[model samples]
Target: MKYTFYLKKTLSFFLFIPFLFFSCKKECKLSPAECHVYENSGSDCTKTKEKNAPVVASLKEIIHPISGSDPTLNMEELSAIGDYIGSAYFVGLGEATHGTREFFQMKDRLFRYLVQNHGFKVMGFEATWGGALYVNQYVLQGIGTAKKTVRKMKFWTWETEEVIALVEWMRAYNLAHPDEEPLQFYGFDMQSVDEEYFWIKDYLSDLDLDLFNSIDTLLKPYVSVADYQTYPSLSETRKNKFKADLVKAKKLFENKESNLVALSSQQEYDLIHQAFVIFIQNEDILDPKFGKGRDFYMARNSEWIRNYVQPRTKVALWAHNGHVTKGDFWAEGAELYEAHAGNYKVIGFSFSKGSFQAYQPKGVGLTTNNVVEEMDCQTVNALMADVGEDNYYIIFDELESTSAAYKYFHKKNPFFMLGSVFYPDSQNTFISLVNLPEHYDILIYFKESHFAKPY
Candidate 1:
């Protein structure tokens, strides 16, 4: 059950930052006004006809301190963020999967800032909930004794460094604050016994033993005591019916290919979805003692936030940038955040090279070692000329920009479009879905020039 790393490539240049470096190199500079475009823009400049347009408000941007300097945030900024402590916030890690030095450094800084300044006590991630609980329990018993055992276990689709670092951080935090309640780390993704069975095997040993015994009993009815090994053969009519049904189930499971290896993508998706649905509906058949399953977990997560954190504590979730982004797949019609309503504030953190350039107006003289551009309405197009022609840009007018349209189409929920499957509904069906309003209160986009570069 151990998690494995599939290293895609070596570290990139952007990920070369050292932990001790208090600030970034001055390779380039932009005016404070230029750096904070949304803040400076008046109503006329910021307003757009798009319903998904970002809601902006002025807040001071913190500049990283110089070499050997301690990072600091002004009181006003700290107070503003503190006010939303009980609310859920989804913070995106910039270039996290790349496992670069800068990514680690930024993550550490953000973690410390949130804990010390923002009063966050819980840290949830994209990891498996049961596996995380197991790791925490093992670490609490003793790291020296538990390290090897913990390494052997697997949970979610995450790198070893990511989970190890998170667990270590929690362990260290608990050690330092002995009197405080231990901070919780959990996962929210729907669970499957096939996926999580390894984590709960010890607890269900007796159940497994009983089920095997029952299966042995059930098999006796179809076999004779004298020749059980050869069992009873089905009559020709029964055999045909069995084969026909098996073929039907196979077709439903595989979707198209006559052979097993070439299943359609939709078939794979349906298989995964069905596995989740079964786990949610049949907890009694799987875990007799607990009688808890997928639906219970999902409801618990929503209830925990609504009843516990939403009332008294602020929580932040570290997940994929897509989940936290205001209109992305994880945010569309997300019921968790809607439960909190006005009490919660979600913010997204993303990086985009284009966003920096987008700040420059139609015409202006821009000079950098990378390129030089003269002011004009087509500045963005001219600046990106060196980039390959196939590099596509997300033009707002080219697609539906509102969250509702994006979610309704991409998630393929018939309810979203009044049960219609044609015209605008079908046409926009390819758009990405997002967890509705709970996604983000602010989005940070970090842009780079090459697609191969770390995002």
Candidate 2:
């Protein structure tokens, strides 16, 4: 009995020994400078700063500070950082406001550098599949009345003077290079009903026609015959009802509008958008397959880069900074690098300090002069004054943060839904308004704050 008790005690001691060993181990919390030195140069924590060494700023300083400024670098230093970057993604918050001259100048310089040194390919502002198709059409054929019609109706911001300039540049590039495919620009967005469904007749076969007709019949009763005949602009009540019904149908279908039976009329517009999503998600349904959305499109783009763009290609993805920002919805933060499979080195361009603040353009009774007043910040007026009016740009800021400022703005102006849809998750990940991921990259407080930026 004594021997057995001793053996049991020894076993307990062995088990406890491992636990104590692990418990006693200390985790070293290194400063950013120490982390940088250790990671980059294999330096120990006791080492002093070297002469002419790179200055390392703390992550806190970068995230929260009086002014989050870029490193003060001369042309040589700028060139060194530029050289380190292989491909760059520029996300414009909105259209250039009057006071953001410095921002634009830097962006322009970056563009020129990518073109001159990196052999960069430019992707433009079209976000829908049809818009991308139209761009390709324009590349093949010069701008004509057809192009203008598509631009006016389908494309949102193409009407902007700045975007027009970019389009003109693309046209000139195409004209100059009659043989080479003008720097490939394709939209990675889903098709909208108003833009592409009417054109389906041109692309669909007899089988597709039958399927579409069958779906239309299934969905016909949900939309009243009178709703079909009513002109969209006839009355506010009629328009609202039409939109409400569509929203209802969208909800009923579990956000799968396309899976439902289709019907004719403006009321059936929501169904069309749904069908597009379904079609893309299930590409096997189409006889001649084409992928849609960023997931498939970016995958294809990656292949294009590997094959054609690999040896010597620098590409600039001119997209919303929201998409490129660290915490953006599609590919931002650590997930972004993981999503890309580390094939492309991605850097986001953001406005460090400017007059730009995101507010709802629609629904709000806002003009260029009153935008700053609508925001939560008290220093907005001063910031606007500091930036000046001539060089600024206005961009549609998508505020995804769930802070007091965001909540206050949304609560006061509930009509400004800001293009978001809420759904419950098993993890209860989205607990409150704050649970949503922030959409903007870097808010460029533009020098002047009034210009209307792009979405």
Candidate 3:
């Protein structure tokens, strides 16, 4: 019962996200106090713009235009930036906000380009490993429908029409390119272990009662691996025991012990076993001794994709800007960068002003509101807005030589951050000091943004 605008392309996968669940409400306006990140009067960092004026003026010249929603609109522009993708095992398409439509569209388009043009064969997400197994089967093979596979996921952000269209496109591309490398979907998160948990049970239900009982015995101690919700705090000793048991249980089928099982099926079971341990390890957040946090596990999962899961050397990663950027501030990205040496390249996202989906003190969808307030005069968003471009991409390498881009290179400064929450406490949401060019190899900016359509 809602009217949303949409367009269909030739062999295209673009679709407008439906906004059926919410009604328009009062326009959420912002005050001067909400814009500034600090108590200092110098929150208006516009004065520093004089030194960066030359780079600002050339913004339109250097940036690749990403106007409109069809990410494939301009092939020449997307191709021109291939050098930025470089010779890396991983090419990351990071978003500024998980709740922005443009972010999803452009990242999808970019990854699609990689699958079609580059030798990149794997498309990984920051989604649950268990959920992605179902999605992976559907996208690579024809096991299930696009909508159904995505709907089965625990994460709400990805359960949208846009994602469905992307998966469908991947399916068609896979069918068409049988001789060439097929497109595969993989998740590199410790989100949940239920799909793997249940799949193991059902898979062994027919063949080996001993294995089923073994898996059951391994799982009986825990309540629910699927929910991962509010479980009792586990001691390191208990965590280690579960980790060892899951590994031993998975090897029962793998390691050539069960020659009757398919290699693919065995591989899946083995991966699930390892991923389950990762899920348990990540539950601890960060390690007390080594400082190995969730990001470390995330980075390790990326390595697993290349080494164990996928045979391809080149892959496309989709996640938030924070997880992809290589720096000490973010453990996952830092670990990925360090693991790859100079082989890894990340593209980061930012927005000028527009409504985006985010949470408040508690639960609520994007709701109808212009939460995408104007940028702080002193921040990076304000600087890019001064460039007067609708949408574009700039190579950080080109700007690294300039003395004027010094502030961004040397020190941390205010940057746009619209996480899942951006209202009431919009002032307290995703405002972190970051060295943009340092954090990302390439930067994509939009003059305005719209909220991501929720399922």
Candidate 4:
């Protein structure tokens, strides 16, 4: 699968930096010591309500870096996160940007800790259900190559060495503990235009030829993204065709028709139907009135995985900050928080400044990575350095909304927001309004970071 480029259409300008460099730009050999966080109050940003709010004391103790990447080395710090997680069956690892190496590394390290220490039996990704199936097979059953299956997920930002390491490690863990239930991967993103067609083919692959053709014909318009790009007017046509086909798919998959082989599980059937739901509404997604329907479906799909699909009662979720943050913007994750009623805990990753990667699609068949240097600190991401650690976790649960710390964290600061696609030299790289305790239960802050190099 190719790197899907649908979500990078907008960006905030206040976070933009003057440097317009790409991946090959002069690499800085800056010292690790020099990278420690600093505050520049003069910069344009959301002034913290308690810029002087007494730095949290019980929470302010300096955090030490792990002796190495071995998550076991930092048991105390890792378990501290578990403290905030409480008894919630689900834990979310939300990243501020898609391509940060530290975010990826810490996520793998953190999840491993949870699985080993906390019994998080399954792990879910922010990928399409169809995209994640193959990787799940490879990791658990050893059915195919890990990297290639991950590539099939289509989100190039995550097709990295870091993820490959995480998958391989999970495989080893599963192999060592055959008697125990194995760790699994689950994808819950709203389907992009491509998977909607591919899933139809796969679902009907076991059907007789005539039946397959009849259904495929109705889905012909949205099969290739190039058609949409070349002929922008095809959106309405795509919507109509998908809606027509969706009716057929719903009828076929809903009833317990014993003869249905290719479309077996209600989960798989739901994925195909869900894809069409998002596909037909693509044109209206940008309209404020209609946009949230997309995110609403995202949360529903994920909650479906949690409530029905996975046998595991507990799970760990991985996704960019945009999808998982409790912000009012994305309805999918927000719906999850609403439905679970505090039964879920979200831990969002934040960064001050660093370069990260994105995909630039070269028409229909190809795409390339561009590591754009993140703009300067203007958000809560910047102020994190004051807590006095290279990396640390802040538990927001203790701060009530009426408290100075709470109001300060709620101010609209510009946090670094890059995902599957980004542009260097764009006016600003920030797309988030930093409301800390409200958006995430715990904030994992990385003062400085670098990009991930995918294998």
Candidate 1 stretches greater than 4 Å from native = 1-80, 83-108, 143-157, 160-163, 191-195, 206-278, 281-314, 325-333, 353-439, 445-455
Candidate achieving higher lDDT, 1 or 4: 4
TM-score per prediction, in order, is 0.43, 0.44, 0.82, 0.76
- Total clashing pairs for each candidate: 35, 31, 7, 4
lDDT of 1 by residue, 1-455 (tens): 12101000000100211112111123325532333211211223212312222211000112112121012323342333345443444333322122222233334445556776666665555444444444544434333423443333343123334345555666777668766544544444443233333332222233244432433342222212212122123444543443343234323433422332232222223322333333333332233333453333443353443233233444555544444333432341133445445544444332222211111133432211111111111112222222222222221212244533333223421111001011211222212333322344432222232111111
RMSD of each candidate?
17.5, 23.6, 6.9, 8.7
Residue-level lDDT of model 3, residues 1-455, one tens digit each, is 00001011111321233432221223324343343222223453555677568757656556666665565576666775676676677887788877778888888788777766677777788887667767777776677788777766667668665677778888888788766656777778765666556655554665567767866776645425323344435566765665556556556555544443452244444554554555455444422343356666778777777765445557778888888888665556778787776778888888887766554454654453435455666677778887877888878676545545543545677786765555543454456788777788888888877776665
Name the regions of candidate 2 deviating beyond 4 angstroms.
1-82, 87-113, 122-126, 145-155, 205-315, 328-336, 345-367, 370-455
lDDT, candidates in the order shown: 0.33, 0.33, 0.64, 0.61
Name the best candidate (by TM-score). Answer: 3
| Residue pair clashes in candidate 3 | 45-378, 295-332, 354-372, 358-420, 358-421, 359-420, 359-421
Worst 10 residues of 1 by lDDT: 5-14
**Candidates by lDDT, descending order:** 3, 4, 2, 1
Question: Residue 340 of candidate 3: its Cα lDDT?
Answer: 75
Query: What would the C-alpha RMSD of candidate 1 be, to one decimal place?
Result: 17.5
